[model samples]
Target: MTPSATPEPSPAPVLVLMATLNGGPALQEQLDSLSSQQHTHWRLHVSDDGSTDGTLDTVAAFAKAQAAHGRDVAITSGPGRGFVANFLGLLAGVRDDPAFVALCDQDDVWLPDRLQRGVEALSKGPADQPGLYCSRSWVVDQDLQNPRISAAFPRPATFGNALVQNIAPGNTILLNAAAAQLARAAVSAAQAVPGLPAHDWWLYQLVTGAGGLVIWDPEPTLRYRQHRSNQIGANKGFGATTRRFSAMLAGRSRSWTDANLAALRGAAHLLSPESATLLEAFDRARRGTLWVRLTAPSKLGIYRNGTLAQAALLLSLALRRL
Candidate 1:
């Protein structure tokens, strides 16, 4: 008699994670956008950091209202877990029960196919070497219209293209189960290291470090709404000389030279030598005159040509500080 073949493992549903704050006005817009996705296998896991403005209660009420209709929705909260920690906290929520995790911001509105397109890309890759993928997004005003994003960066983002600048936002990201499992470790590494920015950057590094792909989807899946309350809004000025001067005077900065150097050095262990070399250049960039730093022995010419990741990062860092 012929022996029965072993069955392949089944795929888990996608989990959408959103970290909320005083997101009273825009929270529903985002949630409504998510609920609009044709892909219904996904679940929304929102972590309300801390909001005196009824943010948690609003989310709770909405989830309950949605659940009465049999929607797979839930609201969870932790102490003021900080923005970065709130994103990481979801990993703990799903660590024992892993799923394809998508990072959702409290404000942005996703298009109908956001999660569907991401899942198609991720589901095709080898599960053992899972990854995170982000799509390009339209930078819009608080009204989510006019072309703020196009005016700000006005360039397509590729893994290599973003080497000097990161145009991807958390709301547009989709991290696989493997990456979710590695989130805590990645955070710990960042804490132990120095210059790493936040959960998003660390997740990118850790997943890509293990030979996993950090795919870039060029489609604009999000209406990236810009407002004052955002932690890191879409930066319009290109290292604007006036803004730079103002930034310097205002003492707004993301990293000192030493801390950035350490973070880059730490990432070396998480990426290929070629990628590591690039990260080193970015790390040294915070030191000033990256051209000069690139000439140093320890510094590698990561942005040899038209690498844009550094500029994107600078914009985000500057925007965050501002």
Candidate 2:
């Protein structure tokens, strides 16, 4: 008889970090979705903000259930700061395991293939180089019915566009060990800088700026929940797009840009020379006249996804709202 073939070992576990605040209602569904993932080699780390609801109890129960399946799950107190900071804390809490890390929202259903697809795509890059994987998401209502696929952005994820707009959605992100380590270091360095932007946006900038690869998959792998209290949801229809444009006109977008720029500048040591030059040009354009703003961005090769959105950017510059 032939000798028994050696069994293939399981791959490194993907670390899924989720931060919660009063997540009782939908937390169970999200956790169940994770349990159903096709990628079995994974662990969950949840950071909970102080909750009056039964969120912690729900997480505890789910953790106990998952433990029987040989999956590791941990629940801990979140950083007292808001959601963005809470996420940063979770990212920093990851150990030096040379594993991929995924960001999870408190209330979303991951498809069975989400983790598997992310890991497969990220594995294509050199392990020594930083890699980021993000995908579009299916926008769903509260009950997870009538799902509409999110529109694909035509604009590429260049450093110039990354400086101003964050096309990366946090829940859809997967970062390899190298990228996660770089992000942790950037987060630490930017702590002194007040008003840092969202963790996903910052990571997009940091990775692209450092000459790392950011793969944007057109295929979605999760259901993005849209509800009353969504911090950020799928940018889908005309209404959503218009609201974003209005925000730019209202200076809200500019404020976010300013904060992001400050954080980028604070972490300048990590940026590649080309990215540094792009950042400088963006800064100068922001302070220049309408003609200079238009001319400078063109030279820098920055653009938003849609033609209309790109036109709006130019209009914002001309109006001095950018």
Best by lDDT: 2
TM-score against truth, every candidate = 0.74, 0.96
In the range 77-111, model 1's lDDT, one tens digit per residue, is 75474786677666657754446888889888888
Which pairs, if any, clash in model 2?
A: none
Q: Tell me how candidate 2 scores on lDDT.
A: 0.86
- The regions of model 2 sitting more than 4 angstroms off are 1-6
Off by over 4 Å in 1: 1-12, 69-72, 79-81, 147-164, 191-196, 236-292, 296-301, 304-322
Q: Per-prediction RMSD in angstroms?
A: 5.8, 1.5
* Residue 61, candidate 1: alpha-carbon lDDT: 75
The local distance difference test score of each candidate is: 0.63, 0.86
